[model samples]
Target chain A: MSADLSIVRGKQTLGQRILGFFSRSVVNIILIVVAIFWLIPSVGLFLSSLRTVGDSSSSGWWTIFLEPTRITLENYANLLSNPTITGSFWNTIVIAVPTTILVVLIGSLAGYAFAWMEFPGRDWLLIAVIVLLAVPIQVALIPLAQMFGAIGIFGSVLGVILFHIAFGLPFAIFLMRNFFMQIPSELLEAARLDGASDLRIFFTVVLPLGLPAVASLAIFQFLWTWNDMLVALLFSNSQSQPLTVAIQSQLRQFGANIDVLSTGAFISMIIPLIVFFAFQRYFVQALLAGSQR
Target chain B: MTQTVVTPAARETGRGDADRLSRRSRRRAILIALAFLAPALVILGALVVYPIVYTLVRSLFDASGSTFVGPENYIEMFRRESTFTAIRNNVIWVIVAPVACTVLGLVFAVLMDKIRWSTAFKLIIFMPMAISMLAAGVIFRMMFQESPQLGVVNAGVVAVHDIFVDEAAYPGANIRPDSGFAKISGAIVSDDAVNDGSTVDVPLIGIRADSLPDDVVNAQTAAPARAGEITGTVWLDFVRGGGGVNGVIDSSEAGLEGIRVEAVDNAGNVVASATTDAEGRYTITDLEPGEYVIALPPSNFDQGYQGVSWLGEAFITGVIILSYVWIWAGFAMIMIASGLSAIDRSLQEAARMDGANEWQVFRRITAPLLSPVIVVVFVTLIINVLKIFDLVYVIPPGVSKPAANVIAVEMWTVSFGGGNDQGLGSALALLLLLLVLPSMIINVRRFREERSR
Candidate 1:
C-alpha cells in the first residue's frame, strides 16, 4: 500500500510539470503566430520599398531574402528628391507643430479654470465639454470649410491649423481637466498662502507638476495632425497639402509606382514613430487616461 | 444699491469684511475663469459647435440653400440607392470590423500575457497604428492588386495553386481566325474529322511569346501514323515578329504545352484523348478506324489566375475593412493588454489552485474582469468606423466609390467630391452624428465609470 501511494504521488508532480511545459509552448506558439500576422503586411511594404523597380515588378517582397543584393535605396532617394513631396513634408511640420502648441496652451489654461477656480455654470460647461468630446469631426467639416473660405484662410496651412486647434480642444481640455482635478488642493492653497496670483500659480505650480499630461497631450496632438488626411484634404490646397494628402495623390487605381508609395509612406510614418518612442512613456499614460475616460 | 456707504470701515477694519471680500472675490473668479476659458471656447464654438449647428440648419434647406426643403434631404438620403448602399456598408462595417478587431485584440492580449516577448509582440502588432490610414490603404491596395506580378497575395496564391492543381500555361491562347479550328460551345473543334491511322497538324495562334512556358521547345512535325495510332502536332501558329505561315508548324514556332486534344465520334462521344507533350506531339494508340472530331476544350484557354480586383466595385468595401482591421486590431490588443495586466493575479492563481483549467479560468475569472475594457474598445471602434471617410474615400477607384461609400465618404462626395450638394452632405453628416451619438454617450459613461472606479 505504501509503495503504491509513493508512485501515485510522483506521477502528480510529473504531470503538473508536463502540463506547465506544454502550456508554455502553446503560449509561445500563439504569440509568435499573432506576431507574424501583424508583421506580414508591414514587412511586405518595407521590403518593397527597399527593392529596385525591376525587382518589385518581377517578384514578391519575400524573394528579397533569396537575393538580398536586389535591395536598394533608389526609391527613397527619388521620392525625397521630388519637389512636391518635399513641400508636403514641410507642410506637415508647419501644421502639426503649431497645433500641438495651441492645444497644450489652451487645454492647460481651461483645465485649471474648471478644476480649481470658483465659477458659476462651471459644472454645466464641463458637461458640455464632455459631450463635445463625442462630436465626430465630420459634422463640422462642410461648414468649417465654408467658414474658412469666407474668412479667406481656406486652402492654406493656416486654415488647416486653425481647424485642428478648434477640433483638438475638447479632448485636450477633457484630459487636462481630469488630470488637474487629481492634484491635491493643498498644493494650490499653499501657493495662494504664499501670495501667488492665479496666473502665477497656474504657470509656476500646475504646469510644472503636469509634465506627463502635457507630454502625452503634445504627442497625441502631433500624431493626430500629422497623420490626418481628411482635414488636410478639405482645407489645404495643392501647394499646402500635407504628406498624407500628397502620398494619396500619388496612388492610382492601375499601375501606380508602388515603390514610390512605399518609400513616401515610410517617410511619412517615421516621424510620428520617432515622436511616439521619444514620449512613449507619456503616450501610454495618455492611452490609459483615454481608456478611463 | 442698499446701504452702499455703510461699509466704508468694513474694507479696512475687518468689520463686515467677510461679505465684501467674498462678493468681490467671487466676481474676480468669474472674470479669471472666462479669461482662461476664452481660447478653447472660441475655437470649439467656432469650428465645432457652429459648424454642427450650421450643418443642422443647412440640412433642412435645398441644394442651393435657397429653398426650405423641410427634412426632404434627410428623407431623400434614405431614398437614394447609392446612399442606401452606403448606409448598408456602414452597417456591415459597424457590425463586422469592430468585432473582428476587438476579438483579435482580446485574443492577442490574452496570448501575449503568458509570453516572455510580450513587449516585442505588442510593438510589432501595434506598429501599423503608427502608419497613416492613407498609407495602410496603399499597402493593402498594393497587396491586393489583381496581377500576381503586382500583388504579393496573388503571387503567394499562385505559388500555392501551382503546387496543387497545375495552372494552364496557355491561358486565353486560342486558334486564330480562318484557322483550321472553329470555336463551338467554347471548345476549339476541327471542321474535318480524321481516320485512326492519319497524322494531323493543329496549329494555334494569338498568344504572346513571353507567355510561353520555359519548357516549351521548337515545334516538331508529327511522324507518319503507325499501325493503329492517330498522331498530331499542336504547335503555336504565331511566331516571334510575325514571320510564320498560318496553320503550319514553322521552325521558330514553340509548341503549345499541356493542351488536351480529344477525339470524338459523330454522336459527340470522346473516343480517345491525349495531352500535348513538350514538342506539341500527341498520339492515341489502339484506336478503331473511325471518323473522329478533334476538340480542344475551353479549359485550355481559360483566363489565368489574376489576384483579387481589390479596388473593383464588388470587393472595395471588404478590402477597406480589412485595412481598418489591420490597423485597429493592434490598438485593441494594446488597450486590452493593459486592462488584462490590471486584473488581480491572485484571483487567477486561486482559480487555478482550485482545479480550474486555463481555459476555464480565463472564461470565468479573466473574461469577466476584462469585460468592461473590451466593451470600451468595441464601442470606441464603432464610433470610429462610422465616420470612416479617409480610407473609404481614398481606397476605392472612381467607378467603385459609390459601392464602398460610408456616410462620411458620401457626405464628402456630395459636398466636395464633385457632387456639389452641401445641403445633402449636411443631412448625411447629421444622420451620421445621430448614428454615432449613442456610442459616444456610452463611451463617455464608460469613462466616467472608470474614473469613479
Candidate 2:
C-alpha cells in the first residue's frame, strides 16, 4: 500500500521536491508529537510501577528521570506476595487459552462448511451469523448468569471460558468463512476426484489453507478473552477471576493503592502486549477483518 | 421416433436415482455442517441466543421470575435514581465520546502522511488500543486525582499555580477571641491602630500549637515603636492544655507566627502591610497613623490548593468519558489510518496541484474518501461505549460509581452489583441493547458494504 503511495510522486521539479520535503518533515514532526502524547500515560504507569508508593504519590512519574535512583521493583514484589492477585493472574491464562483455542478450532471447521459446502439453508444461515454479529453482549448477560447459576458452572473458570468462546464465535466464523472463500473451487474438485471424504478434505486441504485467517482469529479471540473484565466479573468466582477483575477489585476511590494498581495493571497488561508485538501483522490483519467487539 | 426409444417407467426410475443421490449428498452436507457448527452454535445458543431470548421474557416478569409483571420493571428501571442517572450518562457518552474519538482519529490519521517512520509513529499512537479498558481506567483515574500530592493533574495544577502566586503562609489560621481584633466578614480588624511610639499587643488564638512554623518562639513584646511608627505582637495567646492567659501571650505560648497583618485606612485601602515573624511579631515602621484598622488579611486563612474532586458529581461523567476517549481514540486512529492508506493518492495530488492547501485537499478529497471508514469507526465506538461496563465500573470509586453509571453498568449493578433486582436488570439490559441496536445495525451494514465492495 505504501509502495503505491510512494509511486504517486514522480518527475518532480526541484522547487516541488523541496516543498514536498518540508511538507513531509512537517508531517513527521506532527506524527512524532502525537505519538509522544499517546505514549506518555502508559509510560507514566510503567515508571510508577518501578518506584515506591510513597514516591509515586508525592510527585509526577515524569520526574523519575531526574531521580533515577528512586526506581525499584518493590511494587512488583508486593504484587507477587499477594495471593489473590497472583491467583487471578494464573486464572487469566486458564481462561484465555481454552477460549482462544476452542474459538479458532471450532470456528475454522464451521467457517469451511459455510464457505465451501453446498449445504441446505446456507445463505440464510450465513445471514444469521451476520445478524448475530451485532447482538450486544449486554443483552445476554443477565439470563446467562442466571442460567449458569442454575446449572452450577456460574462461578467457575469453565463458565467464563465458555461464555467468551460463545460470544467470540460469530466474528471468528465470519472472518474465517470470508477468508476461506478466497480458495479456488478447483483445489477442492481435485481433492474430490481422488475420492477424498469431507472430513478428510477438511483436515487436509481446508485447515491447512485456513492458517492465516486462523492465526488472525486466534489472536483476536485471545486478546478479547485476556482483556475481558465484564464476562470474568459476572461469571468467575473470587478464586477464578482473571487478572483484569483482580486489578479492578483493587482500585480504591481515595488513597489509591498505587503500588498494587501499577504493578497489577502491569501484570495484567504483559500478555496482551507480548502477543500484540509478537503477532503484529496478524493483529492488524484481524483488526482490518473488523468483526471485533 | 428417437424419443420413443425409452419407456416412461425406465425414465422415471433413472430420474428417481438421481434425485436420491442429490438428496443423500444434501443430507451428508447438512450433517457435516452440523458437526462443525454444533459446538459453536450450542454454546452460542446457551450463552448468547438463549440468554437474549430469556432477557426479553424475563424483563416482562417480576424480580422473582414467578410473577408476570408486564413492563412494570421497565418503568421501575427508569424510576430508580441510579438507573436513570445511568441512562442520562449513556446518552452523553453516546453523543460525545464517539465524535471526540472519531475526530481525533481522523486528525491523527490525516496528519500521519508523508512521514518516514509513520508506521512507528502510528504504532505508538495506537498502542493504547492494546491496553485493557480496565487498565486504562485505572491509569486515567490516577491521573485525574484530586490531590496535588497524589493526582498528576492536580499536581500539575498546583505546579502551574505556584509559579505565579506564592502559597499561603498559614493555612487554616484565624483570629482568637481575646485577640485585640475581631473577625469582620472574613478579614480580622483591630478597633484602632497603635499611635506612634507605642507597642500594640495584637495577640491571637485558635491556631494549633503544632501547626505553628518551627522557627516560631515564645511571643515577646517588642520595644516601643520609634516616633511615627507602630510595632505589635500577634502571638498565639492560648498555651497548649490551658496554661497561658487569653488576652496576653504567656511565656509558654507559641506565636500565631505567620499571619499577614494589614493596616486599613478609612477608605478601606491598605495603608501598611507586614507578615508576622517567628516571634509572633511585626513592625510597621514610619507609620504616620492617626487611625487605622490593623487587619489580619484573608491571606492568613488561605487553605492552599484543594485540588478538584474528580469523582464529584459534576465531573464524574466527563472523567469517565475522557477515559473512554483515551482507550478508544487509538482504535479509531489505527482503523482510520488504514483507510487513509488505502485512499487514492492521485485525487489528493490533483487537489494539491489545483491551488489547494493541505487543509483544502483534506477537506475536498481526502476527507470524503475517508468518511466511510470514519463512520464505521464512529458507529463502532458508539456500540462500544453503549455497552460501556468495564470503565464505568472500574474507574469511578464506589461512591461515585452510581453517578458515573451507564446503562450496561446499571444493568450489572441492579442484577448483581448488590441491587438484587434481576427483573429491573433485565429491563435495563434490554434498554441498553435497544439503544445499541441501531448502531450495531449500522455497523453490520457497514461491514456488509465493505465486504461487498
Q: Whose TM-score is greatest here?
A: 1
True contact recovery of candidate 1: 0.71
Q: With candidate 1 superimposed using the best TM-score fit, by how many Å does residue B240's alpha carbon deviate from the native? A: 20
| Poorly placed runs, candidate 1 (over 4 Å) | A1-12, A291-293, B1-15, B171-191, B194-293, B301-303, B447-453
Best by DockQ: 2
How high is the CA lDDT of each candidate model?
Answer: 0.83, 0.79
| B-chain TM-score for every candidate | 0.78, 0.73
lDDT by residue for model 1 (B1-453), tens? 433644666767765667776767777788889999998888888888899899999999998989989989988999999899999999999999999999999988888867888888878887777668888887787788777877777877777876675554676677777766788877889888878888877878667766677557898988888766888998888777778678878898887768888888888998888888889998877778788878888878776666567678888888899889998898898889899889888798778768999899999999999997888788778878888877887677678878898888888888888888889999999998898788767766765676679
TM-score of chain A of each: 0.93, 0.94
TM-scores of the candidates in the order shown: 0.85, 0.83
Per-residue CA lDDT of model 1 for A1-293, tens digit only, reads 46754664575787787987798898898788878877888788888899887777777788889999878999988988999999999999999999999999999999889889888898778777877776778788888878888989999999999988887888888889889988889999999999999999999999999888999889888888999999999899999999999988877623547687888888998898888766666776776676322
Give the clashing residue pairs of candidate 1, or none: A293-B447
